[model samples]
Every structure is written in C-alpha cells, then in structure tokens.
Target: MNRHHHKPRLVNLLDDFAFGGVSRGLGIFSSQIVADAADCSVVAVRPDALIAPRLDADIIVVHFPPNWRRIAFLLSLRVRNPQARIMHVEHSYTRAWEALKVEQKGRFRLMLRIALRLVDQVVCVSCGQADWLREVAQLPWHKVDVIYPHAENPGLCTLPLPDFSCERPLVIGAYGRFHEQKGLENLIGAHRAGALPGTELVIGGFGPMEDELRQLAGNSPDIRFAGKIDDVAGFLRGCDLVAVPSRWEAYGQVACEAREAGRPILVAPVDGLPEQVGSAGLVIDFTNPDALARAFATLDNQRLGVMARAARRSAQDCGLDRQREWARLIRRLVPRQARPIGVPVTA
Candidate 1:
C-alpha cells in the first residue's frame, strides 16, 4: 500500500488524557477539527489509560505504554504514514513544571527537541508558552503554533448571564485539580481566617492533593467539596464568583469557561490567566491570603454583574475565530493537494 496515495489525516498524539484542562482542551479541539478534516485520530501514548476522548468510530487509536518504546512506535508511525499531518500538543510542560523538575531539564529538553522534530508542527495553547518553546527549547518559531483552545462548555455559552441579585449567600466557587499549583491551600486558609466572611466556598474536582486539601479545610462547614462535576454549567451558574487562583497556568481554561458562563472570575496574575481574563475579571494575588480574602469580602453585586457582562463579551471575542485559525494552520501543514475537500466548519 502506497502511503502517498492515501487521504491525508490529522493526528493528535497525547501522552495521557487525565482529568485536567489539557485533556479537556484536546478533546474539544479534536471534536471540532474532525468535522473540518478529511480524517482525524488520537493516539494515547500511555498504556491502560483510565479515560480518553470518545472520538468518531472510524478514527484510529494507537495505544502504547510510555518511555523509549512509545518513542519508537511514533517514529515507525511517521515512517508508514508519510502523508499524515502529525502534531503533538505539548500539554505536559510549562515554566512552572520545569521549575518543579529542574533536575531533568537538560535531558527533557533534548527529548522534547528530538520528538518534536519528527512531527509536522508543535502546538502550544498559549503565546507565552510558544515563546518559551522557541527560546528555551530551541524549536524554530515557524514550527511552533499558538492556537488558543476554547474553554467554554458549548452547552452553557447559549445561556444568559447568571442572576447576581445578591439574594443568596455570596457563593465563591473554585474547581480543578486540588494540587499545589492550584493554590487551594491559600484559598482554604483565607476562608478559615475569617477573611471571606458572608460567603460560602465550594471547591470541586479531585487530584492527588484531595486528602491534603480536605485536611486543610478541616471542620469548616463553610467550605464544601462537590467532587467531580459532570454538569459544568450548573456548577458555574450556582456561583456568584468563580475564583481561579493558579500559581502558574499555561492557559487557564477554567477562567475562559467561567467567562462564557457569564460569571466573573478572580484569577491569579500568571502566564495565560492574565491574558485570558484581560480586564473582564479581577486579578488577585493568590499568595496573599489577606488580599484574596479582602477582594472577595468587599466585592458588591453591582460590580460583580458588570464583570460578568465583560467576561461574556470577552469570551465571544475569543471564541470560534480560534477554531477557524487552527483549521487554516492544519491545512497548511497538510497541503490541499494531499487532503480531500472538507468544509472549514468554523465558517
């Protein structure tokens, strides 16, 4: 079988699809792209993965365990599928992650550089991260594409602005992996110190830090964990304010989703969170418990409503244009001469 004679395929290779923003982003993008593409597939580079995206039945899934063997498998796939536009979205590394694993910096950089060289392009979710890859990882700027993934729940984007009449208790909601990077401890302490008075804190999602976070919350009846939420819209609608106190974020998808849900967000000023939030939401120093608490305690319903409107507008500004741009870039990677005519769904 001549690979060159076959239809061009867009393949997204991921190491894992653990419950995180990256996986969610990848799944959303994959779902959208498959409609505009001749054929689309996803490969999980980890063996016996707990969960993965429910892609089209016709899409091929190549599963392989992690390490050197996975690299060899990818290399072989590249050789066989010569016309396929293989793009590896780098979801595993960021400046914060590098800082955490400083010991493996040199080896990891070498590995990343080598692995990326095999693919048609490398996609980074944020511009800041794309810059990091070009500067620190020594990848050519041409090969690194910054395609911001839409974080909105498609079902919720059509909903109206949440009612911020201040009728109920000032509900402050935070969701995501309960990890150190999420700054859940600082949030918990702020709540415990009586900084966020007249408010009830709801923490949702699960992670390795679940036990530690529970311990941090202690017997505070004011703080509650909703665990993994399947109904994202219902969760965001219930909150008066959505807080994303990430110590570091490649791109804070939660903030984007909150905005689309018409809920104002309180976010940390780091990486892509600031870029995504823009002037639509409040920027807080998540490390300073006093400042965080004060910001929450003092915010009025009128101001909250204003921020919510701004957030929804911002989300509208950043939405489908990205999907169209991504389709254009993917088309460039696999020339029109190779792939069949498919509708650019964003149009």
Candidate 2:
C-alpha cells in the first residue's frame, strides 16, 4: 500500500485494446515506460480487444476482463511482485458526462471509487478531466494527475508538408464518431446552410449517428464520408484544414494531430480543444450554426498557411514532455536500482 523505495515494476491497465485515442496513447506510454524500466507492461481487460501493434515487443501484456477472475489475478500480481505499482487511466468519464447520465451516477461513482482502491494512481488526460475526477467523481485530489496524451504522430511527422498554394477547393478534415457529442451534426448543418461554399468536408469515422448524419447531409456533394480510416496521417496530408467540433472533449488528439501535421485546425471552444489549438487554429462556438459558418468562411490561403506553420511550431515547442513526466513518475515509484540511466525518453 505504501510507495516502494526501490525502482518498482509498472503495470498499466486499460478496459479495452480498441484502436481508440486512449489505447494508442497508452500503447505509446507503455512503450516509453519499458525503455526506462526493466519491468513495464500493459494489461488489456478484453482478450479480443484490438491493440496497437506499435507497443514495444519486450513489454509484457496480460488480458483479463473485470470480474472475480481479474481480482484474483491482481491479488496474484500483488503477491508475486510486491513492489509493483499499478496505475489505471480513466479514459471514459467526465463531470459533464455524469450530469448527462443522472440515473447512473451512483453506480458510476461507486465503480470509480472501487477501481481507485486497486491502483496507485488515476491518470486523467487533461486538466479539465482531472478536475472532474477529483471534484465530481470525488476521487482524492492527490490520487489524480493530468498527463496530456502525446499529440505527435510518427507517420504524419515523417511526411512532407503539402503545397498549400495549390489551386483546388480547400479540404476540411474531421474525424470522430458521427455523434452529437462530437458536434458533427452542427458541422453538417453549417455546411448545408451554405456557410462553407466552394470547399469540401471529409469526415473519417463511423458510429450509430452515421445514418442520421447522412440523412442530415442529404445528397450534399460537398460532404463525403471516408468511413473508418486507419492512416490518420495520410488523411491529414490530403486536407488543408482539420476540424475538432466536439461539444466536450477531454483532450482533442485530432487538434494535436492537425498541429503536428502543420495543418490549420478549427476546434470548438470547449475543454481541451482550445488548450490544444492555442493560437494555431480558429476556435468557434460550433453550437451556433452562423458562428460556425462565419469561422469557416473567413479561412483564406494566406491565413491558412500562416496558421499551419504556427501549428507545427506549437507542437514542436511542446516537445516530448510526456516522456519526461512519465520518467519522473516512474522513478518515484521504484528504487534507484531498477531505474535505467538515459532511457531515451524521446519517441
């Protein structure tokens, strides 16, 4: 129950291995952690969950769903590796989310409390999310920490910046489930209302809202769905701008990816999206269709080029702080003997 004096083995746990932002972020973190410590691995609860292949080969992986079997497994782990520090990143909940699901609040809070008892820390991806964890979820403030997910995409970083001066309709890329939370409906409405004429909207993702979204678009040639995409870097490369019009976002990885790709982004002024966008992209109140359209209509080649370059510079300035932060945290968990020197924290 107490923090170990020696370098402790670290085990990161997640509810699924699905190819979502959280999974990718954890995969990258696990890989980085293993490079610094001899014993670091990840455990995905579902055996059939789709995991990121990029996870380091040496990092051990375990699969067990949350049940009595998992409790027994954790008990075994606690016994076998007494000094091991286990941490769980709560990727799915927010204070706003709790407000929306009033009936489930009691059970959700209980689950969070019980889950926290099993781990050394509860990592939230954004400051706003940390606030929700500590205040709304009633997690001990000390147990919650904000660790922003890395925005750098290796594939996108390696690609050359596309020609922004080309004579073509400016492409606006948006990737997320066609859900109300994502504000994609608002985006479609703004487009359909002729706010962003002479431009194309390319959406890359699938969900329950797909049918409804398509119905909203209603034979609009300017709107195209690329289905679920695997290569986000390639997708960004084809676009002049990226959009993150979420009603609420813990951390907008798409905004980061857009910045990393040096493409200007238009993000809803909410939560982590604004924090990520900074001065590099336009932040509009997507809830109002007119405001969203006006923001889109103002984009010109000159402004787009300037913002794109700013985005790249912003991402560069942030550096790989996530690695260093992880290193510092992991060092505190275990003794000096287990901590490797110069673990190459950079990706």
Identify the candidate with maximal lDDT.
Answer: 1
Model 2 steric clash pairs: 6-334, 6-335, 7-334, 7-335, 8-334
TM-score of 2: 0.78
Q: What's model 2's lDDT at 49?
A: 33
Please state the error at residue 315 of candidate 1 in Å.
1.2
Tens digits of lDDT, candidate 2, 1-347: 34333334445556566777766776555555435654556655444333222222222223222333354455444444433455556565665556654476666666556545665666787887787677655678777777777744667655566566888888888998777779898888888887777889999999999999889989988999999977888888788888888877878888888888888889887666777776688888866877777776677777777888888888773436776766666665444653344332221
* Poorly placed runs, candidate 2 (over 4 Å): 1-7, 30-34, 46-82, 104-118, 139-141, 158-167, 317-319, 335-347
Candidate 1 lDDT, 40-79, residue by residue in tens: 5665644533333333222222322223444565566566
Worst 10 residues of 2 by lDDT: 51-60
